[model samples]
Target: MTDDYILVLYYSRHGATAEMARHIARGVEMHGVEARLRTVPAVSADCEALSDSIPAQGAPYASLDDLKNCAGLALGSPTRFGNMAAPLKYFLDGTSNLWLTGSLVGKPAGVFTSTASLHGGQESTLLSMLLPLLHHGMLVAGLPYSESALVETHGGGTPYGASHHAGADGKRALDEHEITLCRALGQRLATIALKLGNDRGPNR
Candidate 1:
């Protein structure tokens, strides 16, 4: 566990959200910070953690320490009918312990998402993901209009957060505009995290 990193946390079914997370991580590094990419395991019908101690591919399963000790966070997920996917939500629900101790207070955070259609609740999903960070007392930030990709995007990009409009079949590769915004979101979080670092000591 590291206290000097931004945690890039997300859940992806068709890989779009995971792809976005990678881009965000790149942006975080661009801002001269380490980015810890992490994911949650899928849950069973009763919401129990799936048997594996770690995921077979992509990022490893995120520990509570990942969330608790992060300097900042970038949460991403595939859209679940205008909300975050259940796996991501399930992981957040376990953070009540961190909330009680205010471990996440004053940390900067951002969100990103992928949707199956152009109107498939991208903004809503982004907003939905932010709710948990807000409750954790994180200082959540969204992309500012200063980023030109927000105005030129035909794919998925929102002032609310970074997003990708995966085609209905879920095969649409991220367009340049969507990629830009994802990196922008990551950069924003990293920048804010560094500025806030001096004012706040390590929560861990």
Candidate 2:
């Protein structure tokens, strides 16, 4: 309803996931939809711990309004033992209001992740991220084999969604295939979101 935008929400520790978010945002824009980039703060063990209202750098923190108004969603995170990072999970846990309102129902969503090791559960992480979207009644979109990169990627790319292998030191950049798949996923979600929005019509 806010002029057709896709929300690229993510939590990045070593910056790999942030880079992936950027590529995905580019793909969303390619479909003539605005891409809103946002990130969540890291969780702290201290009961009194709290992050600044604004992040020191990179994208600002996300709000429930961003999620509720998004025509589509692209979620990214660094893999944590085959699950999404706690920061992202924490933010999502707070979206129960949206869930209760069914604000995100029927929206398009996609997931992506970065792992430190090649076998460090990239696909599992992507799948785990999809669970909440499904609960929100989102229509999930994944990269198909037609993306070519899903077959050609030596580093990272998957039918589940886009992914990247950041290596043990976490310095590795996204390869051509990973980048390609990220964009492909974003484009697919954006295109689908547009079609769904059109179907809803101005009066609906």
Task: List the candidate 2 regions with Cα displacement exceeding 4 Å.
Answer: 47-50, 200-204
Flag clash pairs in model 2: none
- RMSD of every candidate to native, in Å, equals 1.7, 1.8
lDDT tens digits, residue span 78-112, model 1: 99889999889988999999999999999999999
Every model's TM-score:
0.95, 0.95
The count of residue-pair clashes in candidate 2 stands at 0
Ten contiguous residues minimizing lDDT sum, candidate 1 = 195-204
Error of 2 at 41 (Å): 0.5
Q: Positional deviation of 24 in candidate 2, in angstroms?
A: 0.2
Model 1 clash pairs? Answer: none
What's the lDDT of the predicted structure labeled candidate 1? 0.90
